[model samples]
Target: MSIFGKFHVPSSAFALHETLTAVPEMAIEIERVVVTDEVLTPYFWISGVSPSAFETAARDDQTIQQIKKLDEFADSALYRAEWTAQVQSVLYAYTEIEAVILEATGTDQRWELRIRFDDRDQLGAFQDYCERHRIAFSLQQLTQLSQPKTGGQYGLTPKQQEALVAAWEAGYFETPKEAALTDVADELGITQQSLSKRLQRANQALIGNTLVVSAEYAAPDAPDPDLKH
Candidate 1:
């Protein structure tokens, strides 16, 4: 049985510490990571700062070997970063245990990471490893991925479920809208942007699980009757 864990690590203890500190409002969402030849390369999305500003800050960070902007949008940009080999942090620990990173987001204040471990033992080992290396992390939530239940909660993680329920109860989905986005975010003890992201993911999961069907399960298309031999 796999287990999902959410943790919070202070920015000072994680990668991109300098860059995030310089751009305090910047938010990062790691898209994927690749480790090869003892070097870790991560592709991530960055928001709240211009590409030049982010690049300048990243260039000065000792932990980063190189940074490249892959794509840019009005408010956010995608970047790839190669971490220096000498920099060992929680990310290295994750790769050591072969844990799957479900979601990883960071800010100047802290980093929120959701990781999936093979089982209870794997999760325990990860915790132990962090302790041995004095890598400080606060465990936010731990959930066992059990058999799916056909209930009101489809396949949402605990945080997502909480956000969705809170939003609904706050009348966020009502025609008149009883509560403001800030109000809901404050109630959930998170930033408005974080709340919005969570709600979006929750809605997507709900629709995908309930309304959408796999291609194999969907009805087959009618055969074409065109006169082509």
Candidate 2:
């Protein structure tokens, strides 16, 4: 199992907020920002360009109509811009670096940026920046789902467990009926034949017997290698 960390850092960076106000047609309230700064430095460097470029690009009024066009042409481009900068800032603090994940969210004067890293030092630098900037920050450790203990006493394979979860979500047991078997199968990317087999196994293991096993089983193996795609 891999140990992962989550950091929530608040920044008063007005650059993003100012950009939103320029386009009246586009109304976006940030629900959250997700980012990975696995290998980023602490300093951000813009190509010999003046800081005003950022300020001007966001506050420019003449681009209002053009910005509306952008919404049509590049729906997710603005969001991508926001995500890239927020991630790059922490990752490229002093130099170019690869990031694990970088996410940003919020609106107006309050924005939360999250960065994740495998190494502790990168996370430390981000924490330091948050303290120096008076940004509220939090750290959460992500437990690996592949770990053995998560199975709890059922001794079900992870795939079987996941299929059972999908059944519940699909409302297979619901009164009015919910998601179909094919729906769940499609979501899991498995043949209906496979999904059914796993779901049945999970049910029998979890609910069939009166006496339940108290011991939790760990994963037999790590995640599938093909899932990276």
Candidate 3:
């Protein structure tokens, strides 16, 4: 069985920790990652700061080899970063254990990550790798799936799944007003508040599981011994 895990690590335990600390208000969402020969190249989206400010802060981060801005928006920018191969951060640990990063977002204080591993042994190996490297993390959630394809539902509870489906069918997610919240609640035989909460949780689960798992970069056959802590 595959395991889905969610956890948090202080900024000090991952790549770009210094950059995140420097820009306390900045938030980062990892868009994609490619790991090869212990080197990690990740594309990320940054908001709440300007590109120049982020570049300046990144200049002092020891984990980064290079960073290039790919696009810019009014409040957010996209960037591609190459991490130093020898840096033993949690990202490296993910590569070591062959874990797929489902979602990773960072703030100055900490990073919240959701990852899927092949099995319990792979998950255990990830934890062991973190311990060996002295990388501290807080485990938030753990779920086991009998098969991988079953993750389409993202571990939503029966009631949550039902509420979400009903709401969608009622057009509660439409851009223009197709259905009102109260109407969806009535259809589900639940209060508006309960329906809202269920929808919120369901949406979060969908995002966390579906985002950033595509376009995996091929890794080498064996881990790099030199990169081991």
Candidate 4:
């Protein structure tokens, strides 16, 4: 299964606006306006923006009244009032960022989250928010590769075997492939340096066993000649 979600944010909130703008092509539009708890004061109903132009206007800080070329329903006076309410609500800090939870498939779960901020100050706040909530976050893009020989292989642990097999398939011998040791490490949930060391030890054992078996087989030809004589 895969899941996707869109998070709504108000343009008046500079912090959120900056964050949303950094994401390509995504836009926020006012959906409804409301007043929340007394302590929180103002609140807004917002959803993703459509028609692209509306998004452009909102990001450019154009007044809702100035946005003349809106969709039929969107251009109406009632809609303009709603949009104004949304902007005002955000200015007063009535809305806060709720979590955007997207249920993803095993493969999609591996997707690396790439995020950017307007500047260092916003970056610091975002980092703090993620850390406080213990969110597993990364800016790098993520991909997943399947391994065929992963089930019940050697006496090695799942992580150890995954590293070993990935190394083998990638050709540790004559020439290296485009495969990343770090990818294997990340998939197996281990450190790259540690996985490398484990692969090395595994290689040594495999080589030593093959050499020993070949030597024992070579002794058979000489012994068989005595029996023929």
Off by over 4 Å in 2: 1-8, 20-88, 91-97, 132-229
As for candidate 3, its clashing pairs are none
Kindly provide the TM-score of model 1 when superposed on the true structure, using C-alpha atoms: 0.64
Q: Which is the winner by TM-score between candidate 1 and candidate 2?
A: 1
How well does candidate 3 score on lDDT at residue 169? 89
For model 3, how does the per-residue alpha-carbon lDDT over 36-142 read when each residue is reduced to its tens digit? 67667777777777889999999988888679987675666778888785457546555656787766777888888878788898888888888887889999999
Name the weakest run of 10 consecutive residues (lDDT summed) in model 1.
Answer: 218-227
lDDT of 2 by residue, 23-79 (tens): 322222221122334322111111112334433545443211112111111112222
Identify the candidate with maximal TM-score.
3
For candidate 2, the per-residue lDDT at 118 reads 45
Candidate 2 local accuracy as lDDT? 0.42
How do all the candidates rank in terms of lDDT, highest first?
Answer: 1, 3, 2, 4
> Candidate 4 lDDT (Cα, whole model)?
0.34
> Which stretches of candidate 3 lie above 4 Å from their native place?
146-167, 170-229
Which scores greater on lDDT, model 3 or model 4?
Answer: 3
Candidate 1 residue-wise lDDT, 1-229, digit = tens = 8788999988877788899999887777774566666567777777777888888888889878678877676666777778775456545555678786656788888888888788898888888877888888999999887766522245455567778789889998999999998999899777777677667757766776679854222111111111011
- Candidate 4 residue runs with Cα over 4 Å from true position: 1-160, 169-176, 213-229
Instruction: For each candidate in the order shown, give its overall lDDT on alpha carbons.
Output: 0.71, 0.42, 0.70, 0.34
Expressed as tens digits, the lDDT of each residue in 84-123 for candidate 4 is 3323323332333321111111010121112223344444
Q: Name the regions of candidate 1 deviating beyond 4 angstroms.
A: 147-229
